[model samples]
Target: MPPVLDEFQGLSAFDAIMRHGNLGAGAEHLGISKSTLSRRISHLEYQLGQPLLHRQANRLIPTEAGTLFHQYCQQMLSLGERSQMALDELREEVSGDLSISVHPHFLRGWFNRLLTEFIEEYPGIRLTLTSNLQPPTREDDQVMLWLWEGPTRDSGLRDEVLGHQRQHLYAHPDYLRQHGHPQHPGELASHDWVNLIDRHHPDLVLHHPEQGEYRVSLPPSRFTVDNVVVHADHITHGAGIGLLPDHHVRTRSVAHPGQFEACLPEWQGPSIPVSLHYPFGHPPRKLGALLDRIRRHVPKDWGQP
Candidate 1:
C-alpha cells in the first residue's frame, strides 16, 4: 500500500488527539474506542521509532518530536483541504454538461423563460433537455423535473418542491358561444369536452370554495390528446372544453385576446405539484449552482386556475 494510505488512519487519530488535547476526547471525536485510538498511536510511534506524546495525568502532552510531528500533520491536513477547495472552485469555473428531463408542456410559458435565463446566466454549462411523460431514469448526476399531484414518496432520491400549478377548465369563446356557457359543474356533462387524456380521467372532479367537491362523468369526446400544448391548442381553436394549467391559459389569453375563456370559473381543478429530483447526495458544484438557480427562479404561485 502507498505510504500515505497506510499511515492515513494513524495520522488522523494523532491529529484528533492533538486537536482535543486528550485520548478520550479524541477517541470520541473520531467515533472510535479509546483502546483503538491508543493502539493506532502506538503503531504510529513504533513506525516513527520514537514516542510522540507523553501521558501526563488525564491529558496527553506532545513530546518535542510529537510537537514537530503535530506541526507537520497540521500542514499536511491544511494542504489537503486547500487542494480540495481549489479543485472544487475549478470545477465550478470549468464548463460542464448538464442533462435535465422535463415534461414537454413545461418547455413553454414561464418555465421556458426561466430556462432561457438559466442558459444566459451560465454560458459555461451546456444544458441537455429531454422531454418525456414519465420521470426519466436518473443517471449519476442528471436532474429530473416531475409534475406530480402531491408529495413524492421515494426515499432513494432527494425531492424538492419547485411550485404548484393550478389546472382549470377552459374553452374557446366560439365553442362556449355555440354550446352556451355551463353555469355549474353539473352542467359540464352536456357540453363538448376537449380533454387532455393524460391528465384527465373518465370522470372530471371540480372543487368549489363553499360547495366542496363535485364529480362529473365526461361523455365520449371526439377530441382527446395526451400532450398539454396540443390540448391547449385544441381548446384555443374551439374543439371543446379542456383542463389547462393556469399559467398556460393566462399566457394564451395575453398573446391572443378574446381567443379562449374559462369554463365554470367558480370551480377549480386539482393543482399539479411540480418538484425537482436528484440523486440523494451532494451534487457536483456546477450542478449545485444550476439547482440553486432553478429554485430561485420558480414562482411561488403559478396563479390560480
Candidate 2:
C-alpha cells in the first residue's frame, strides 16, 4: 500500500518549493516553516518509495526522479490556474491578481489613471504592472499582460487587438517659434531631429507619404535617446523636433498664449498597433477586469471600434 502523503499533496506547495530550491525560501513562498516543509517532503518520499531530493548546505536539490515530478508539478499548477480562471470567468468577477508588461510611457498616462479607477471598482483584484517586454519568468505568480504595437497573429498566444498608437511630429513651442515650423517634409532635414537611438530599428526620417515608410541614416545625436519618455520630456522642455506617439503627447498645435503645441499638420506621422495577449481559454479574473476596464476606456479611435 502507498504511504500517507496528505500534507504535501497539493501541487502548489510542491511547485513553490521546486521553484525556489531552498527550504527557507520555499517555506517563505508558501508562508510556512522549514521544519513543516521538511516533514511533508519526507512523507512524500516515503510514499513514493524513492528519494525525491538531496540535502546540501541546508538546501534542497531535486533528484533525477524529482526533476520529472517537478515538470509534471508545473503542468498541474498551470491547469489549476486555468481552472481558477474559468471559475472567475464564469462568475463574471474581476477580483484577483493582474500582471502586465507595458511601454514605459504608459505609466504616465491612461495605465496610471486606469489602475486607480479599477482598484476603486474591484479592490479585491490586485494589479501588478511590470516593464517586461518578453514573457514573464516561469516562477512569476502573476499572469502576463504585455502591451502590443501591431497585429500579432502568429505567436501561439491568444491575443486581442487592444488599440492603435498614433504617432506625430512634435517640438517645443519655444523651439518652433524660434526656428519656425517646417511647411513640407523635405524641409524637415534642415531643422535638428531628435533621434530615439533604437538598435533594432534605425531612426526614421525623410517621410514620403506616397511611399508609406522611411528609415533615415543620420550621424550622432542632435538629441539621441533610447527611452521614449525621455524624448517626450525633452520635447516638452523645447529641446528639439522628435517623433512622438499621440498616446503620450495629447496636444497638436505649436503654441498659444498659455498652451504648448506638440505636433504640426504637415508632418503627421504613423500609428502602431497594440494588443492584449494571454494563454488559451479563460484567463485570470483580475486580467479580465483590467482588460475590460481598458477596453471600456479606450476610445474608438484606438482601433476597437
Question: On residues 93-175, what C-alpha lDDT tens digit does candidate 1 reach at each position?
Answer: 63577777776777767666776877787788787777766554444344533333334565456777766788788888899
Instruction: Tell me the number of clashing residue pairs for each predicted model.
Output: 0, 5
True lDDT of residue 219, candidate 2? 36
Q: Name the top TM-score candidate.
A: 1
lDDT score, candidate 1, position 80:
63
Per-residue lDDT tens digits for candidate 2, residues 167-267, read 67777778899989876655556777777755212445434456555554443456777667777677767766777776556532323332246545544
The ten-residue window of minimal lDDT in model 1 covers 140-149
TM-score, candidate number 1:
0.70
Residue-level lDDT for 63 in candidate 2: 90
